[model samples]
Each structure stands twice: as C-alpha cells, then as structure tokens.
Target: MYKNIKVIAFDADDTLWVNETYFRDAEHQFAKLLSQYETENKIDQELFKKEIENLKLYGYGIKGFILSMIECALELSNYNINQKIISKILDIGKEMLEKPIELLPEIDDVLEGLQHRYKLIVATKGDLLDQERKLEKSNLLHYFHHIEVMSDKKPTDYLKLIQHLDINPSEFLMIGNSLKSDILPLLEIGASAIHVPFHTTWAHEKISEKEQEAADYRTVSNIKEVMGLF
Candidate 1:
C-alpha cells in the first residue's frame, strides 16, 4: 500500500525530538512567578487563553510563546508585574531555546533505514530560526532532502508542499504526533499519514473522537515500529 509513497515527511516536535516537555515546564514556571496575582490553575488557564488569542498575530514557536507569557503576566498583575518577572519570562524562553536536542528513541535508525528508499523531509511548524538551529544541533540534516518550516499545517499547506515536490497527493505521506495538525489535514488532502502519538499532546492539538470518525491511518506507540511499515 505504501509502494506509491515517494516522500515521507516527519514532524519535528515531539515526533522527532522532545518539545512539549519544555513548554510545560515553562508554563509551570510562569504560573509560579505569578502565584501572588492568581492561583496556579487560574494563571495556567489565562495563559492558555492568551496564547490561543495571540496565535493569529504572532504564529507558533518559542518567541511567540514568550510574548504571550509576558502579556499574560502583565494582565494578571494588572500592569503591576515586576520588570524582573518579565525578564524571568524571557529567560524561560531562552532556556528552552538553548536546551539540548533530545531526539526520540531510535529515530535516527528509522531515518537511516528509510532515507535510501524515500525522499525524507521535515515538515514542522515553529520559528524558522529556532527550527533551523535545532536541526543544525540535531546533526540529522543530511537525511532530509527538504525542510519545510510551515506557518500552519493545513490541507492547503500540504497541497502546496506536494505540488512543490512535483508529486501527487497519493505519493506523499506524513508522520507525526498530532492527529489534528499532522494526520487529519494530510488525510483531508488525500495523502497518507501515520500517527505516532507522543505521551503529552498540546491542548490545541487534541481532537474529539467524532473528528476522527472515518479517517483511516495507522498508529504506532514507538518510532521503531515505523520501520516495519516501510
């Protein structure tokens, strides 16, 4: 069934490397910094709301997240938030940026085995500079023929990528942790996708069961299992 697939696009965050863990840590830190202004739960809720509200304005990734945290802090403290706290928020983002790349187990072996047979590429959403830096640090850049830093992963976006690769929808496949962004959109475009769910999913990426009712795709608990499919 995969014989027609010519391109294999992998999601970078969570799928290839640990990402959400850092964000979760940052969120907790932010909440603790603002504990006097609001309860931790309330602060977390407000920050999530603010991040979603600001998505259209700033897009995704660490820089946007940093801005959102600062804005959330200011509003929570009624514009009375300490400058030092604001500086600490920036530090959180910086620490996340500087964190070492911890790739998923056996990911390199999977890539190594499949790279020779397929056109492997990374299709992920994040700040362009941050993503590029991660890829560089990861030292797995040689495996990919293309690297797409998507603004948003939608059916139309994948369509453009398919066209850019000069391939039909049937020839493209996506593998990622998020069903909402990585799998569902590709399925809508008539491309194949494999779901490799990460243990912790972002709230925005979680979809209702009804949304996945009729979609057909394979799910694997581990990256190593992917090799058996190809």
Candidate 2:
C-alpha cells in the first residue's frame, strides 16, 4: 500500500519488543516491598498511579523510572524504611536493565520483508545506554539504516531525524505503539504513522488529541498486520 514510501521508522520499546511487561513486574515487586510499612490498600493501586503520574512529569527513560521507584518507595514506606530497603528497590531496577532483550512475534519477518523496499530506521526515546543495549542484544541492529535514541519524542525530534536523513516527510512512515510519542509528532510534520497498540503500555505513552485527527494515521492489530498497510 505504501510502495512509494522511501523510509520506514519504528519505535523501539513496546512497539518492537516487550518493555511494559518488565516495568509492570518491577512495579509489583515494588509494591511487595512497600507492603511491610503501609497498608496493602494504600500502596497497591495508588503506588502505580503515582508512578505513572511521575512518568509524565519526568518523562520516560532509566533516570525517570529510577526516580519513580525511589519516590514510590519513599511514599509507601512513610519515610521509615531503612537504606537496605531502598537498596533493594534500586537493585530491582538494575536487574531489569540486565534482563534479556526480546522482540514481538513475526517482527523479523516484517522487517525482512520491508528492508528490500524501504530504508528502515529506529526512532525511539529513552536512555541511550539501555536502548543501545536492547538493540545490540536483539540482533536486529543490523536491519536499521539509522537509530535515534532521544530523551523526548516530539515533532522536533522527528523533524531532526528526517532532516538528518535528508528524506522528505511525505516519503517517510513511522510505525509505533505510543500515539503520544510516535504518531502525533510524526503526523504533525506531515509524515504518515501506523499505530500498533501494545497489550501493556506506560501511562506516559498515551495518545493526544491532534494525533487522533491526522488523515495519514492508521492503526493495526499487531506488528504482523503492519506489513499489510504498506
């Protein structure tokens, strides 16, 4: 469908692989740790809610995630937990960092199918090291012509990437999970975008209003269906 498209950019986290699963697991573990000092009710749902709120204020990446962990730990513990408890939470974050990288099913086939026809690029926002580690470990690094790991996913970031590639916005298409980060910004700049919703997504990655109206935007059930759009 998009045979004329010259560049296809993809978001890296939940779009390509399993990211929200790890964060959800970490939050559960975090709640377990908080239960010792606070009531289960107070620390249960509210803890995750606060963390999600923090993500919006601080943005996504390891630094913000770690900060949210710390904040939730302190809030649930009521400022009484010892350093060891805090250390354990931080250790959980580190453990998440070390976990193996994996991709969604049929991702390889889709990439392989598109590689011959379009310039593939990974344009995502997150910690530089963590994102690079993920790409390197996934063994999918070689498929992309360029990899953009930014602190934020804004229209400017998309503009910058397209400018760097010397490609027209009309010739590019972005496929991703987050409407906030991936679709809206690219659509704002006149690039086409495909939304592939993940089963679990960080709260900060939710879609915005303008993104919902872009004519070039399309939604697919999964990564495999994305190839059909093009």
Return the top candidate by lDDT: 1
Give lDDT: candidate 1, residue 111.
96
- Across 1-230, the per-residue lDDT of candidate 1 in tens digits comes to 79999999999999999999999999999999999999999998999999999999999999999999999999989999999999999999999999999999999899999999999999999899999999999989999999999999999999999999999999999999999999999989899999999999889999999887778988999989988997
The residue-by-residue lDDT of candidate 2 on 81-186, one tens digit each, is 7798889988988988998987898999999998998899999888888899999999998899999987687888888888999988888899999888888787
RMSD of every candidate to native, in Å, equals 0.7, 2.6
What's the true lDDT of residue 204 in model 2?
59
Candidate 2, superposed: residue stretches over 4 Å from native: 39-59, 208-216
lDDT of each: 0.95, 0.82
Strongest candidate by TM-score: 1
Q: After superposition, how far is residue 71 of candidate 2 from its true place, in Å?
A: 3.1
As a TM-score, model 2 comes out at 0.88
